[model samples]
Target: MKILVLLGALALAGCASKPVPPDWQADAKGALDGFTDDYLKGNTAAAEAEFRQARLATTATGRADHVAQVELVRCAAQAASLVFEDCPGYATLAADATATQRAYADYLAGRWQGLDPELLPEQHRPVLAGGPIGAVADPLARLVAAGAAFKAGRITPEGIAQAVETASNQGWRRPLLTWLGIQAQRADAAGDAAAATQIRRRIALAAGQR
Candidate 1:
């Protein structure tokens, strides 16, 4: 009876909220809410402090450390917006990214590691609602490819630039734009100026009057 009850509890927990797809509005909203809730209740300072601690939990010297830094980015963005228009300075973006990355890592709980990529669902609705961002038939595929390339050091600056250019010429939207910009920045920082320039130009074009 106890075994059956335990299984039932696990089943109920699974039914409550499934793993959300990347760039899903619902998932993003959940993250936003987590930060906003912390930002409210006079806990902004505490949230920021938590990010700092998460940073210390990284590998001593490796990409994983950089990955951890990415989580801290979330906290910084939340802290700024919680104050309405009084957004924090541009300098806070780094911290915001680090915090965000850390938060994602926590949410992911190491599930992607060694898991069969094919087993994961192709697409999922965000925890929040938004129209389908694209018709790629496999949005998760892009994220997984990008992540694999990142882990393998194959996503160089030039590669990112090329991808951004391609995406731009093809008239991609939403999450694609976001991904291009992010990948370009990472590649540029890793020494791919061409990729960064291409991404920036596309972004400027998207904004109009660039």
Candidate 2:
């Protein structure tokens, strides 16, 4: 009986280890390619539909979703006009100049988010952290700490607003801008009209002409 039980478990494990279905990758890639084509043609709805279908196909149990691929294609299509002035291939993707430029800016912002700000080398940690707070000096880590503070209402909106301004001035983008917006909303809820107005102005100014 024990031997039979062991054999059953082994068989189950073997079945579970089966390789991913070959069709999934090919189907996902094709769908992603279709999304890009539709986007390039300015068919936003059709591109979005293709991307959604591709996401579903890529979500198979044993396969990784092709989220990055789909997102890149969509970004390339939708924000083509906003590519930052510094992008390498900006000249070639000028068909939808405005959307491409925006896509590049978003791409850079997304790339910044992926970096583990806290884990940066020591010299860079203080800059990212916004100050020297021992452990939370890494700017991203400080942002997480700020969130917890906000949730607990332990830190005042005024304080968070200051941090956001400092971080934004440091050339950090989304994280700083996001926190500033949060602080503004929080101030509004607390009826601190002065603080809320100031934060809103800061956000608008930070957004610049872009």
Candidate 3:
């Protein structure tokens, strides 16, 4: 995922005065990267374990912002998979979070009121301006935009199609299944039985069913 920037920021924050332990930085990055990969591939158990390890590494810094960055990274991955949660972990550290971090948290939560789009990721900036989400070239960025659009009740059929295509192309099984399921629901709701059936077949394939 595109979380290296946030990780770098966390590392910089930790090294503002004294140098952060190299082991802690390595452990946090490795665990966080593992968590993102495992979560995207649907390895829930491994993802959870890695997430815990990442959090532990960050917590060792004794800085709430470091932990908050970890939580934000987790939430961003979940968002890409179309999983919507309260992000209570981030809320707990909101007070200690940077303005940029708070803006991102609000962006992920669909609270666009008074939000500064400039603070958001470049791929997401256009989304806040009512631009087409399909225009975002990055696969993960496209999915993030789709999830945010869905939360904002502004997701278009084209956005959903692009997200499905992106997930399928990337072999992201977890999100492929979720987006396919959503497509099936939309087709069913619109009385397109044939389309819904086709989507369900794709869902079964993604889920490793015959």
Candidate 4:
């Protein structure tokens, strides 16, 4: 996943519990709503604008924590948008972020950085552990970790396959579709006939559903 210019919902960075000013909350919430609405509607250009609006919200009446949180949201949007092949890492954002908020950045960094387990701190393990998929608290997050694991050379294709299956079972269609499309292309390039066929079929089914 490229720098998540997040094209989807789920405010990963807001997981932090910074004391937001009451006055600033309205603008922040508005920007978030606009960005998410535009993104889901496939208006990426507009989505980018809305996210920028979010950034602007931090410029006025925001603390350092608020600024970091806004950047985190922007980064996630960039990553999910797939506008670029490489998304920017949270770097200090992860380091300085609230414990709750940092995991999202850490995991995203882990994916972009190629399965570096160090990116995911020890405290984050519970969420990253489990069966076919990682923890089931959020199937999307689990799938992300599984993909990162494959890239880092920690898991075989079988491991990812199981996670993918579980994601589908959980009805995570959009993210699953997006993932399948990428995997299909990779399998095709690698001449993995079995994987390519399976991924393609899944993609086709997913497309039809949409």
Number of the top candidate by TM-score?
3
What's the residue-level lDDT of 72 in candidate 2?
Answer: 37
lDDT of 3 at 41: 87
- As a whole number from 0 to 100, the lDDT of residue 210 in candidate 3 is 82
Model 1 poorest ten-residue lDDT run? 1-10
lDDT of 1 by residue, 1-210 (tens): 011110111122224386642332223233333433343333566645544443333322333434333242342233212121222322343353444333333222322334433332233122111112232233232332333333333444443444344435434333345556677668677898886787678666664537
TM-score of each: 0.29, 0.32, 0.91, 0.55
Instruction: Evaluate model 2: give its lDDT.
Output: 0.46
lDDT of 3 by residue, 1-210 (tens): 545554655453345588665687778888898898888889999999999999999899899988999999888778888898868889999999988889888888788878899898777898988889889877777787888887878789998998899889988889889889899999999999999999998898889998
Candidate 1 vs candidate 2: the lDDT winner is 2
Off by over 4 Å in 1: 1-110, 114-118, 122-170, 190-195
Q: Which candidate gets the maximum lDDT versus the true structure? A: 3
CA-lDDT, candidates in order: 0.37, 0.46, 0.84, 0.53
Choose 1 or 3, whichever is better by TM-score.
Answer: 3
Could you give the candidate ranking by lDDT, starting with the highest? Answer: 3, 4, 2, 1
RMSD of 2: 18.0
| Poorest lDDT segment (10 consecutive residues) of candidate 4 | 1-10
Candidate 1 has a TM-score of 0.29
Clashing pairs in 3: none
Residue ranges of candidate 3 with Cα displaced over 4 Å? 10-21
| Cα-based lDDT at residue 173, candidate 1 | 39
Off by over 4 Å in 4: 1-21, 33-42, 77-104, 111-124, 127-132, 143-159, 162-174, 185-195, 204-210
